[model samples]
Target: MKLVIGGAYQGKRAYAEGHDSIQKWANGETCPEEEIFSCEGMVDFHLYLRRLLQEGKEQYVREQLIPKLLQENPGIVLVTNELGYGIVPIDPFDRSWRELTGRICTELAEHADEVTRVVCGIPVVLK
Candidate 1:
């Protein structure tokens, strides 16, 4: 249900997006055009997502996004990159976002029934 997806966008992004699309397909709905969540790099996107998660806004995210997702499909596949695996960023704010997202993903992974790691084009199961 949760995965720490990592790879160059060309490779792994498709997997995450495709999986989400398939869920829509099964529900008799057309999948929307894929948005590249990793531009400015996956790390940046994830960091922004993490801040949203950690701030008091998490409840809003969950209330608005999670429940609707569960209602639409039996399974919810969260696609996120494994940002903690890389070198520390030079920018202080970038560094903070990395740490925040890394922690958020880690916690989610633990609660998830399964956790997967994607590297280059390879996937390794960690849980």
Candidate 2:
């Protein structure tokens, strides 16, 4: 399975629509944060989403989820926000997460049979 995980809004939304639950093995509660979470900021869907895609989370997804997906599924096109491409996040955990998610996404895209970015609902193939 090939996935394009990012930190953006619409990208995850599209992926969310296809899956019944966002917390499922693929993108849903695929993996819980290993530590206790203290609600910060507004804790709205988006901010918490940013926290969900926080860097360390991807490692869990990669290890625990991706393999199972490949085993039971023939192919998958996963999407996530591109968080780290912009300015540095103020929070230490946030910054670390940005780098981690970015790196994982890059690896996923590289090994993907195809890779794309949707701008205004149009996908531009990157590789």
Instruction: Please name the candidate that would achieve the greatest TM-score relative to the true structure.
Output: 1
Model number with the top lDDT: 1
- State each model's CA lDDT, in order: 0.50, 0.48
- Among residues 3 or more apart in sequence or in different chains, the pairs in candidate 1 whose N, CA or C atoms overlap within 3 Å are none
lDDT of 2 by residue, 4-104 (tens): 34445545456434432333233323334431121110111223235556544555654653344345442544556667568897888778666665665
**lDDT minimum window of 10 residues, candidate 2:** 35-44
TM-scores, one per candidate: 0.55, 0.54
- Runs with alpha carbons beyond 4 Å of true place in candidate 2: 5-7, 11-26, 29-74
Q: Residue 114: error of model 1 in Å? A: 1.6
TM-score for candidate 2, please give it. Answer: 0.54
Per-residue alpha-carbon lDDT of candidate 1 for residues 1-127, written as tens digits (9 for 90 to 100): 5454674462455555543444222110122212222121122336346556445555554455334433443244555666676789998766766776666566656665666666765667788
